[model samples]
Target: MPCLLLAAGRGERMRPLTDTTPKPLLQIQGKSLLQWHIEALVAANARRIVINHAWLGEQIELALGDGAKWGAQIQYSSEETALETAGGIRKALALLNPEPYFLVINGDVFCPGFPIAAFTSRFQAQLSNGNKLLAYLALVLNPPQHPDGDFYLHGEQVNDKPRDADFEERKLTFSGIGIYHQSLFADLKLGEAVKLAPLLRSAMAKNQVFGEKYAGPWHDVGTPQRLYELNQSYDPK
Candidate 1:
């Protein structure tokens, strides 16, 4: 399946740093965060990459070029303004091929050990079995920045409703990594800004969304402080 890397957000939280550079171009260890994701995807043999950029979009093009150096085919989906998540995916759908399912990752996130091949195999199996999942999210333990978390996971399914007061089920954060079916965005209007949560929630109501908890090295590199800490501790190799 083709992959879409979301690199368009104007990093308002990073302020001065993002004033001159896009968040994906921010350095982590010795390499740019976007480069890390690109390398990881390349390693996974996902050579056809579609990146959507809005803030500093040209720089991203200049930095990565045709992706030949990385042994991948790169395509750009330039946006004049940030189109949010769902909208960006909708806009870039054509470049993602005719596959019913494709991978999408947030450009700002840093997940070093994501098992892409394994996840892809599982997703393929689920689809082959005739299951109708609009999307399957990779959930993670809540970080300090978002302690309450986003959704509740029961078994391998996701639900919009929070767990009961008993706290038997733990709420987890959306890791920003997911495999989505094209049908999920079939009703969306192109070029409009639309957040993904509402769409996922709507699908969850019909039991069309699934999830799995991934307990691994993952960080939301939203702020400079987090980036600094990650650089200090992480060895990208």
Candidate 2:
């Protein structure tokens, strides 16, 4: 399996700071977000990665060259304008993520503890079961900022149906970490922008979307306040 780093957004919510630097290039502690992910993925023995960039994209290429420093091979997919998630994936389909399943991540986040090796087990199971789309969503307990929550979890499946009095409140936020089968993007056309929500909803409707609760600390790392917070708290050993 391969990985795709979704790095192309312009960071509208993250204003003035983003005016100069790409969000992924923003520092958390001493390391850049992109650098941290690169090192972690390489540690997981994930040797190939595809990164799509649009805003301040050129600098990303300059900062992380062929991935030799991190022991991985990197390829870039350029988007003149920010293409929502689906379009970025579609653009990079050929060079990377050509296989059955691949991991996709938002570049602007800090997800140091996300387990990359777990996919090996999931991939084997999907192979045997002939599963078409197996998305391993990273779920989080609701935060004060996002009280509504993103989805509900039933085993590994992500259900849109809110919790009822009869069911346990399995409120979970999409950790921005997910594994996707190439088949998930099957209907997506090339050369067009597409958001991932509707597509995932379609899969969820079919019970093909799965999720996992991640207790580890993950940050959206948006807004100036968040940037200051991460810079103050980030530590890697």
Candidate 3:
């Protein structure tokens, strides 16, 4: 499957740093955040990649040319303005549309060792089954900054609400990583700014979304403190 690395966010919270550079290009531990994801994706043998950019997008193009250095073929989706998650995906549909399922990763999040091959394998298993799965997400424990969390995961299914009265469910934060069927963004128009949560929720209500809790290392590098702390304390196991 191909992959889409979302790099178009304005990164308001990462001011000063993001003021001069795109958030995905910000360095952490030696490599730029976006590079980490690219290397991981290449390592997993998912080489064809698409990156969308708006703010300081030129620098992103300069920083990682054709991805040939990493043995990956990369194409770019340029937006005149920063389009939110869903909108960005919609804009890049031409590149991603070739495959029925494509992986999307947040450019700002730093989860270096994430098992892309394994995750996609699991998602493929879900797809091969008779059930029509629209999305498969990787959920993580909520960080201190976002204690309320985002979605509920019940068994292999993801839910917008805790519907099962008899079974307990854990609300988990979206790891900013997921495999999506192209149809999920079929209704969206190019260049329109839109968030991805509402679409996921709609799919969740229909039991079309599946997710698994990832216990591996994951970090949402949204703020300066989180970035600083990760640089100072992160020890790759």
Give the TM-score of each candidate.
0.96, 0.92, 0.96
TM-score of 2: 0.92
Model 3, C-alpha of 43: deviation from truth (Å) = 0.6
For candidate 2, write residues 208-237 as lDDT tens digits: 887677787787887889889777777765
C-alpha lDDT (0 to 100) for residue 62 of candidate 3:
99
Query: What are the clashing pairs of model 1?
Result: none
Report the lDDT tens digits of candidate 3 across residue range 1-237.
889999999999999899999999998888899899999999999999999999999999999999999999999999999889999999998987656888999999999789999999999888778778889999999988899899888889988798677977668999999999999999998789999999998998889999899998899999999999999998755
Candidate 1 residue-wise lDDT, 1-237, digit = tens = 899999999999998899999999999877888888899899999989999999989999999998999998999999999999999999999889746889999999999879988888887777787878999999999999999899999877888686577676668999999999999999999999899999999999999998788998999998989999998989756
What overall lDDT, based on C-alpha atoms, would model 3 receive against the true structure? 0.91
Q: Show pairs that collide, candidate 3.
A: none
For candidate 3, give the lDDT of residue 20: 95
Best by lDDT: 3
**Which of the two, 2 or 3, has more lDDT?**
3
In order, what lDDT does every prediction score? Answer: 0.91, 0.82, 0.91
Q: Is candidate 1 or candidate 2 better by lDDT?
A: 1
